[model samples]
Target: MGNINPSLLHVGSTLGAVFMALMVIFIRLKASARPVTLRKIWIPPLGMSTGFAMFVVPEVRFPWWWAVTAFLIGWFIFAYPLMRSTVFEERDGLIYAQRSKSFAFILLGLLLIRTVLHEFINRYVSIPQSGGLFFILAFGMILHWRVYMYKRYTRMALPKAPIPQPRG
Candidate 1:
């Protein structure tokens, strides 16, 4: 915002969001029994990408109508992901089992923002001092989960096959 224009910011942020979305979606899709499908691939990325767009709102002081409009636009686009399907076998279910965990993370964040619509999660919007603690915590979570996910995905420690009895 210091030197960047809105259009540039928009494009940059949108692209960045898309890139991250792809990474996260890839992680989810790799957990599948089948190869990744375009339709399924887009869903996680769409939700994540929209949420990422919010970071690009320059100075964080949005004009009232524009802010509300942005909210509704993103809301409409991502709303469907909030609900679960008891019927559709196509959808991911269970925590970290399918893509459900990613969706759950997204919806939880969106719901938190909805609760704090008048303000953000923190009281102060324009303040940046030390985010080390946050980064440290995030790092810990990533490390813990990355190990677990890797293990789970690879079935790292299955019991060894019992030795076959000698056939006389």
Candidate 2:
């Protein structure tokens, strides 16, 4: 324990987060407005849920209220901005989405916020509790963002009603 360096841990985490943010920025830059499928839209939430399940320990005790609060905060603070930053358009018979640069910045901001909060929580909470809470927070953000995207895509994909023909 005496040999462990807290600054090193913080530096490593920050570096990893910066790398991820850079990757996201690169991906966003290369991504163009394209037609999206239902299957693709559902993948994020499903993946996040699966990851949450994998991280969850059956024996570790977690506060239910804390999880709920984290989830709600993630949903409102992170997910809403991400969803709003995504621009959707209907072209021809397909639904297309173009995520703005602000989306990447918002994601980076969320990552930074989560990291700071995790470090703060680590001061008073056990590792298991902090990890579990963070997992729940990420799950909520991804779930809400994907669900909103799915709904928006489906609504935009719906067939428009044909105009009524006037009497000849």
* Candidate whose lDDT is highest: 2
Q: What is the TM-score of each candidate against the true structure?
A: 0.32, 0.79
Candidate 2 stretches with Cα past 4 Å from truth are 1-13, 31-33, 54-61, 163-168
At residue 164, give the lDDT of candidate 1. 100
Q: What is the C-alpha lDDT of each candidate?
A: 0.40, 0.75
What does candidate 2's lDDT look like per residue over 1-168, in tens digits? Answer: 246586675577568767967886786565545577888777767766765664446633476888899899878877888788877887787777775868777888888898888789889776556767777887788788888988888788878789999998
Evaluate model 2: give its TM-score: 0.79
Top-scoring candidate (TM-score) = 2
Query: Between which residue pairs do clashes occur in model 2?
Result: none
